[model samples]
Target: MQPHFAVPNLAVPTFAPASDAGLPLHIVTERTLEAWLSQQDAATAGWARTMGFSGAWGQVVVLPGPDGTASGALVGAGSPKSRQRQRFLLAAAAAKLPEGTYALASDLPADLSPEVECFGWLMAQYAFDRYAKNTGAKARLIAPEGVDAARVEVMAAGETFTRTLINTPAEDMGPEQLQQAVESLAEVHGATVTTVVGEDLLAQDFPLIHTVGRASDRAPRLIDMRWGSEGPTLTLVGKGVCFDTGGLNLKPGASMALMKKDMGGSANVLGLAHMIMATGLRLQLRVLIPAVENAVSGPAFRPGDILTSRKGLTVEINNTDAEGRLVLADALALAQEDTPDLLISMATLTGAARVAVGADIAPFFTDREGDAVTLASNAQDAADPVWRLPFHAPYEAMIEPGIADLDNAPSGGLAGAITAALFLRRFAGEARYMHFDVFGWCPSSLPARPKGGVGQGTRALFQALPDMLALS
Candidate 1:
């Protein structure tokens, strides 16, 4: 197993100790780029003209000192006043600069938050080379004075772990592979891991999980990993359908292209688990993942069948394509058995959430006001946006199926995200449960963020967990 690093609260480094100490930096917005450089002193102005630097993302120009040494540098932010803050530009610039520590010499505007700097550093360090070639540029940003180095490393690890898992194709990442990933973390953090596969799931009373994944060539499994001996117990359950062929009800060509990222929820929970264990946060952690592949075959569970869940609740399958919730139901029920201080389940369960919030934002559902605020605040702080939708009781009526205890999916299209939450809520019961319906893929590239399997909610949840534990 690879070595794991902790997220510590170390003493901040002082700028006086920087290798490039006293070096000046000029920040230029797009509108003033040419004019500002033209007005600079002879040596500084000469470099700008030679470089033909326009204030684009990751643009950099350096001026020479009297001894032909480096004098100052000009880094561009496309537009500082624009509402959209391009976070990765500065860090990307920092990474490409010569090997010397540098500070943000320009004055930051009053409205800019510390997150810009924090996320900038994070984006600069980002790389996912698990399976693909990644002989990429090295990250060399000087840790800003007073920055929390430990926390940033922890968050980056979480995000990287998530992206690595999601980005890998399903062929290389099945139920067993998912368990292996969990085991890797367990070994790193000295946690305990247990998994039940195929017939073993039936023995364990995870009938719904068993039924849903039986058709797959690779056997389905449930991964349960534990960490932290004492403190408030916190459980995380994530739906881990490694690949979803939509069973009998198959998805269209465009839709199935990214089915490999179906286990995004499992990736997310593991990422959050990484953060908690790395920080050595005060909480007893337990993670349950119902890992499987919903493939079509003669033995696959049909749409009209009634499936028995770990909680003993019967669910009638309204659609075979809605298999994510089926697996989550079993995992959530298992989580509730412990009745931990807090229960959070995350899944890329419904396309309705995507339709409602779009690709950039993830919508979450929770019962408590304090939990919502903390999650929202942490999400904002992390720059990983998560929106909260009501666990509105009235919508529960929509999931009520005539034939069974509940329906996998309701007949009507209205409130699809909410209805799915209500379905998962049935397994949660009175537990302090919060569910994140995340769109695990980035639709297109934006600034530092690229288009591919994107890991959404864990960063904010990682930051929020400690406070939530304290309140509990």
Candidate 2:
């Protein structure tokens, strides 16, 4: 069950009026902070000091009105730089503080984006209780007035759901369970759903998908769910390897700890789908997830194996561990068949991406310049960061093979992430394709985000889609 609200409605927080209102809020920036407190009655200063007014995390200082009653709260976020570095610091602090309405005594730091603050607050309210033997403490924050509470809830809860799904162990997140997860969303949003599984994949011509999945007992499948109509078709494809043991090209024990999040791309796609449908955006939506487990058994597909893809391209399995591209090949082929107006795919497909951009930033590749610009702009506005990496045609040779149509992996170590995108691009055809090689697992707990599976690029994509569709 969802946890109880941390901040109850009876005591929701408010912001100061227009005289103090603006984005990149210096909620407690030094300049206005001292002056604002000085203007308040002596009781305000005393209460603020009592609550630890220096702006440290977990410091719960208060402000009192002229009558000596609590006016609001002034939770300190240590340094202005600290506020920018960690989005959730203030929210987490407010969640555990005594219940009451609290206003931002000053604007947020200039470096802190509005969306960062908004999303951060939502993060503080998160609680994963699905497996909890006993309910834990509820954490809630009052939504600032003028914000769409439901929209905020959707983005926040959707992100949490994505992370939760990816963070769960593989035992609880197999292909079947992945399908069920999508089905649950379909039921809620009235989206149409379909699945192509097992032997039917062969009949339907998803040969690469069949080849790689043949070893797993749970059955490999492609999940397709659709929402919206009467506008540009926006197809979101996700690589859903529920768990990757790296096939016969086995990963070391150390490498396998986070394999449960191998499908982070798929989980994140579903999360973005949730936000889109919740907002009732004016665009047709199609979600495709090629769910499989890259396991090893006598029947597992091996290196040098050649398999035909759903799009009729032959691929040589240079490394069985490179299974994400194989499954994405089939799903992307399917997505391409419709020639959707916009085609985007997300996957935790390459470790090179993490090495290249680190965990916090998602490195994305897109075929269109306009799309890249729009996405980057939206990412800035949404405070969800992504960097555009070229689809670099010259690197296409990395996956070129002498025997089969293409190699599942490149022989050269350089440009691993770009080559992977080029590999998936082979299946994308001429559709305006964009791909995100996301690091699904967060390495450690940060202020707003916990250390676990993360849905890296969904919010930026969600924020951009509306405008992308408008132009389309």
Quote the lDDT for 125 in model 1.
47
Write one digit per residue (lDDT tens) for candidate 1, span 1-472.
1224332211111222345455565667677777886777776677776788776656877667779867667777666545255445556565656545456666544344544555555554455555555522333444466666567666667776777788788988899888888997788899999999999999989898899999998999999999988899999998899999999988887889999889999989888888888878878999999999999898999989998788888898889999999998988888888889999998998888998899889899998999999999988876788999988998887787878889998987888999999999999878999999988887775544556677788878877877878833
RMSD of each: 4.5, 5.1
Best by lDDT: 1
Instruction: Give each model a TM-score.
Output: 0.88, 0.88
lDDT of 1 at 421: 94
Worst 10 residues of 2 by lDDT: 1-10
| Model 2, runs deviating above 4 Å | 1-26, 47-52, 55-71, 77-84, 99-115, 133-139
Which residue pairs in model 1 clash with each other? Answer: none
Provide the clash count, candidate 2.
Answer: 15
Q: What digit string (tens of lDDT, one per residue) describes model 2 on residues 33-61?
A: 57656876776666665655665644555
